[model samples]
Target: MRTAAVIGTGLIGTSVALALTRRGVTVYLDDADTTAAATAEAMGAGSMAAPESPVELAVLAVPPAHIGSVLARVQGRGLAHAYTDVASVKARPHHEIQSAGADPAGYIGGHPLAGGERSGPLAASADLFEGRLWVLTPSAHTERLVLNRALELVSLCSGVPVIMDTVAHDRAVALTSHAPHLIATIMAARLENAADESVRVSGQGLRDVIRIAAGDPSLWRDILDANADAVADVLDTYAADLGGAVTALRALGSADETRRKQAGADLDDLLRRGNRGMHAWCGNRARRPPVFCRCP
Candidate 1:
């Protein structure tokens, strides 16, 4: 596409605009938050207003909750010839467009699986989506032109496009993204009452585990609510594993050598399986953890 409009100049939106602008595409920016959009423009990301006429594509990079309504209004107004969104969840918005009687032919559902524990235009980077997965969910009524435009946008943003049905995309993200964020929040919440000694002894392991807890709670709440059923399924499975861990830990406190050994072995097996699973997911073998030693 020669020109594109990014409708939410927050982090993802600004990053997308930056990527598009860098690649010589004329980008027009629009957001309810004028300051955010202007800031993105001043940073050379794109223009601070939508073009007078319909652009090649309009990317609605708003939160999942705002996507459907925003897209409906924009598309209704003929803001762009084709449209897509960068919301985390897809199914809800896809249904929303159909229910609202918006032209599904002009739009596709998109989600770039890349973000940081940060927010706003200032946090945006042109390379935010680099080497990351971008999912496109095109319904039966979706036009090929719109789907191609979405894929082109993903390519310009340095993302790898993976096309899947809306339902599959939502469920996959619930397991790999949403559920993990919930776990991180839970882990970090426990640290609120941690003793001074406990906090003082914090290591990289704790830091890695709770990194996502730094994300905006309000955003996460909306995302979790949107895909509650899928997220709940993941949480239920995690709860079962947690229960097993608790039972094993209690058994370790007993005097019985058999129980203690069994618990230790069980924990070891779990960790090994986790390592293998992660390695397989990344298509790589496990590497040794970095060792730090002080000279005496």
Candidate 2:
């Protein structure tokens, strides 16, 4: 906990380094792109110089696909006593480590449920993870010291720790983060070919829905590839809902009054269900009945 090395100087890595530095932990920063590490160092996140010896912990903030390789490389060099990662997917990375014949006792899986469309050291902020849920996935063979080091890192970053199994962590993110990110990108893609007049009239609702679509496509492709099954499960349900909405939209012009009425009812039900679901993140106030209308 006294000293740490951040293996990637991108947004999450730099943010973590900055937070740790602010907390008085000696942080040594590194990245494949030396300029990135230098940028973080210039921002006062940490020193770019290699540590004289092994640090207390090492945090891998690389892409999911590179996590295992980077971990093995660092561990082989005795870079740090314990290690963790901030990759979005957990299950695949754990598998990769096992396949690489890396020691699991010194490693723990982690994902900080925070970040924005912006990336790189320039976009990093010490408070990026504040009040966010940072998940940790520990295997049966994972050492208590490694897990404790990860928890300490999370604590220093002002994150709320939620322990979960690797598979559960993957599935949860598919529902909460990955699926939604894809959904946003899909929505924003529509505007690429949209009529100028149509796009010109867009409002806050459009911006809000498509905000995350600005994320790097290559990075998202890696995340989606690693957790394809879990993400597909969530998207399958969304596809069904989309099909039903399309049917309802076509029926709105039906010749039969009954058909139109049924379609209206279906659309209303979908809207109400969405309102109810929003309560999960929006808190108890969202659960209360509308003051102006008692209807569900």
Score every model by TM-score.
0.93, 0.94
Across residues 201-220, which tens digit of lDDT does each residue of candidate 2 receive?
98988998999999988899
Give the root-mean-square deviation of each candidate in angstroms: 4.0, 3.0
Query: Measured by TM-score, how close is model 2 to the native structure?
Result: 0.94
The whole-model lDDT of each prediction reads 0.89, 0.92
**Across residues 174-277, which tens digit of lDDT does each residue of candidate 1 receive?**
99899999999999999899998988898988999999999998889889989999999999999988898888889988899999999998888888888776
Best candidate, TM-score? 2
